[model samples]
Target chain A: AQTVTQSQPEMSVQEAETVTLSCTYDTSENNYYLFWYKQPPSRQMILVIRQEAYKQQNATENRFSVNFQKAAKSFSLKISDSQLGDTAMYFCALSGGSYIPTFGRGTSLIVHP
Target chain B: GAGVSQSPSNKVTEKGKDVELRCDPISGHTALYWYRQSLGQGLEFLIYFQGNSAPDKSGLPSDRFSAERTGGSVSTLTIQRTQQEDSAVYLCASSIPKGLAALPSYNEQFFGPGTRLTVL
Candidate 1:
């Protein structure tokens, strides 16, 4: 079984500031993947970033980046230059041998101008 | 028309009524997934269909929930008896199979707009 955990229920960030959301996952498989998805008010889920477990380097997409620690099983998302549009629900997911992703409870991020 | 699409974006039903949600995955994609997101909760996996293989129904909450993919293109999730607890946003996603190289990006999922089901 795979489990993903996001301890923070809500986070706030000022415009142009940076915020980091914490996430940790547990899986028996050595090869796996981690992802961060953002759900806006429209309720459409958009992929923010993805990281392969085997990769030593972290993954980044524009202002969105991930700090992935394979041994510690920690994958956190950091958003730089936060904007009002970045306010949304962020979910962390893990997919391994099953190819089925298990998602975290989600962290509601609010960016204030 | 290019991404995953779901119908009846919003549904309102009374308790004990049955509801059916539909999903149409992207063309040529062989993997489809259904998930449920309740108020202030994370997404709960409902079921998964990969190509012609049997769906992984382990994540289904109960017998009341069932899904089927026909011709590996379209899928429908049927709730036998609706309950207030069943009220949530149902999401559908589709992705191409992971190629032999196993590049993680190749299997990235494309999600639909989602259907919000409200049971009274």
Candidate 2:
């Protein structure tokens, strides 16, 4: 079984600043995918970014990027130029060749102006 | 384009009653998933459906829960003899079916707003 862990329960970032949320997972499978999802006040889950385990290069989506260290079983998300809209509950997930994904306990992020 | 949608954004039921939550995935998406989010359990996958393959119910917490995807599109998660602990936000997600040559990005699962179920 694969387990994802998000050590931080809550995080805060000043407007226009940057914030990095940590995530780690335990999986025996070699082929897998990692993802970061955001859920806002509307309670809609949105995909932030994704990283393939085979790709050592980190995944970047504009302000959202991931630092994926396969050897260390770590995948952290970095939000640059954070805005008020970035304030939401972030979740880290792991999915191997299967159709289901295991999610971590979300981290509530607050962007303070 | 319309995104994934779930009906009855909110539902309230009494203990021992049965409840059904529906999910309408994005058009053309061949994969659909059900998840439960609560204060104690956080987020947990309940079931998954991909194309014509057998749905995965490994994450379901108990036998009281069951789900079915109709015509490979809409899915319904049913909970029998609902308990107070079953109260939570039920979320649904969908993605393109994974093929032998499918890219990782194409497998991204888009989620619905979710249904908040309260069992009192």
lDDT of each: 0.90, 0.89
Docking quality band of candidate 2, CAPRI definitions: medium
Clashing residue pairs, backbone N/CA/C < 3 A, model 1: none
lDDT of 1 by residue, A1-113 (tens): 78999999999999999999999999998888899999988867988998988899999999999999888999999999999999999999888887678889999999999
Leading candidate by lDDT: 1
The true-versus-predicted C-alpha distance at residue A99 of model 2, in Å, is 1.6
* Cα RMSD to the true fold for all candidates: 1.6, 1.8
Show where candidate 2 strays beyond 4 Å.
B98-106
Q: What share of the true interface contacts does candidate 2 keep?
A: 0.55
Best by TM-score: 1
Q: Best by DockQ, which number?
A: 2
Every model's TM-score: 0.95, 0.94
Report the Cα interface RMSD of each model, rounded to 1 decimal.
Answer: 2.7, 2.9
